[model samples]
Target: EDYRAKGFFKEALVNFVALLGWNAGDDREFYYLNELAEKFELERVNKAGAVFDIEKLNWLNAEHLRAKDPADLIEPLKAELNSAGIDFSGRSDEYLKSVIIAMRERVSFVKEYIEKSPYFFLPVAQYDETSKLKNWKPETGPQMLRLKEEFAKLGENPSKEEYEVALKLVATELNIGAGKLIHPLRLAVSGMPAGPGVYDILVILGKEETINRIEKAVSIL
Candidate 1:
């Protein structure tokens, strides 16, 4: 129960424990429950005591998560989000699917989707201190305000490329590298040092939300 709460799927847990005392005589580490039933052999059991390796279980859990379709993860993820008191109201299943696609590789557990990137479900409560120091600058407020104007120019349902082009135009107009705007923009929207591509985050958040977060950052940070 504890492991499931921590995002270990039942299949992953069963697969990991099965290998602790036996092998199928190959390099394969992943197996479905049915596969395990077919492959288990008495002669393959190890003579030495098996160690409970939590790290290996974590890896297997991640593998299982990656193997699943993003849509398949939505209900379980929603349950976890509700348990954690995350309000995903007004967000669609497609929106959640985009988040899963973006964050799946970055997280090993289901709960980590909300834990590592709370900005997805809620507004930026606090900015990352280290990110603020590195990405936000004294002149960043005015620069972000200018960037916000460019974002405001975008139509509804803008593409990732549109966001990228807008940022590049802002950088060119300021006579600075895009990184100047990119780093600060990422800090403004995600409140994290890193995650997915900045443009991807912008696209997922949509034009209004993206511009709003920038305005908030400019005012506060």
Candidate 2:
């Protein structure tokens, strides 16, 4: 807003995407400062106020996140997580790699995964207070805890080999339906009632982080 009034649209446009709410990747991201005037298309621009729509921003973020290679996604996520005091280095890159896969559906931006899934880095400080009480039952916590314990024994990091075995065990023990278990588990770990596929979340967060989140949720209950 400051620079835009000064007739610096290019700098302001870049600034618009860099601050509190920024959409970093355009097909034009690769364009140099020298090419700004030629590449800049004013026709496609939307005129709007700064009353942020989370849904629209999140969808934009997901599109950008998906466009990035898994390996490439890690560096920026790592930088953000590090600034937030999360030790992504100690955790497996495989987990980080798969995390991109897990979160792309639910989150709109790189910052969002950190914001929404802070339990992956920090312990969850606040839960969805309304949903917490509305949805969580005493029995549900223990059921999830028991399943998480069993899930941990599968392997260090889940592979196709171990995942199949774990699914078989889940089918045998849980017996009722995977959705029943998955629903509660998703809520426990993410604090959202729904999200990207569960198996992938487990694969990315890894067994330890997944179990840690479950145990923390159970303790809170």
TM-score of each: 0.96, 0.60
Each prediction's RMSD to truth: 1.2, 7.3
| Cα misplacement distance, residue 25 of candidate 2 (Å) | 23
In order of listing, the candidates' clash counts read 0, 4
lDDT of 1 by residue, 1-221 (tens): 98776678999999998999999999999998899999999999998999998889999999999999899999988998899987888889999999999999999988899988888889988999998998888999999999999989989989999989988999999999999999989999989989989888998999999999999999999
lDDT of candidate 2 over 1-221, digit per residue (tens):
65333222243344335323323336433323445545455554545544554444444445555656778877767877876777776667766776666776666556667876765665557667666766677677767777776777876877644654665577478575655566667767777655666666666666777788888888886
Cα TM-score of candidate 2: 0.60
Whole-model lDDT values for every prediction? 0.91, 0.62
Candidate 1 Cα outliers beyond 4 Å, as residue runs: none
Best by TM-score: 1
